[model samples]
Target: MLALRDGQLYVLAPDGWTRLGGPAPASSTPLNREDAEDWCEREGWDLHLLDQVPQLTA
Candidate 1:
């Protein structure tokens, strides 16, 4: 699963929570699911397919 905390993105990996990259823009706009998936793909991080993970709230 993925989460945005403190303007940064993180992905839950087997080893533990791993940071994906730099901080996100401090704008009102939020990252969508599709974009996050694409990012994980480019970063070579496996995206989990679980629905129990809670959504990230602003």
Candidate 2:
């Protein structure tokens, strides 16, 4: 899922945070939804915005 938090964007998975962008050099620079779409599409995936990201359990 795509989550915008603290003025930055992150990509998350069931395990935890993962790199964004597809098959490209991973970037720390945040990506907005539109750019995210292009990235995911390149990998044959779709970007979906989540209303909330569940807190990670420590």
Residue 7 in model 1: lDDT: 61
Task: Give each prediction's root-mean-square deviation over alpha carbons.
Answer: 6.7, 7.0
Encode model 1's per-residue lDDT on 1-58: one tens digit a residue: 5566656676567675666786654553555778767766887766563222334566
In model 2, pairs of residues that clash are none
TM-scores of the candidates are: 0.40, 0.38
Q: Which stretches of candidate 1 lie over 4 Å from their true place?
A: 1-14, 18-29, 49-58
Clashing residue pairs, backbone N/CA/C < 3 A, model 1: none
Quote the RMSD, in angstroms, for model 2: 7.0
Candidate 1 global TM-score: 0.40
**Each model's lDDT:** 0.60, 0.53
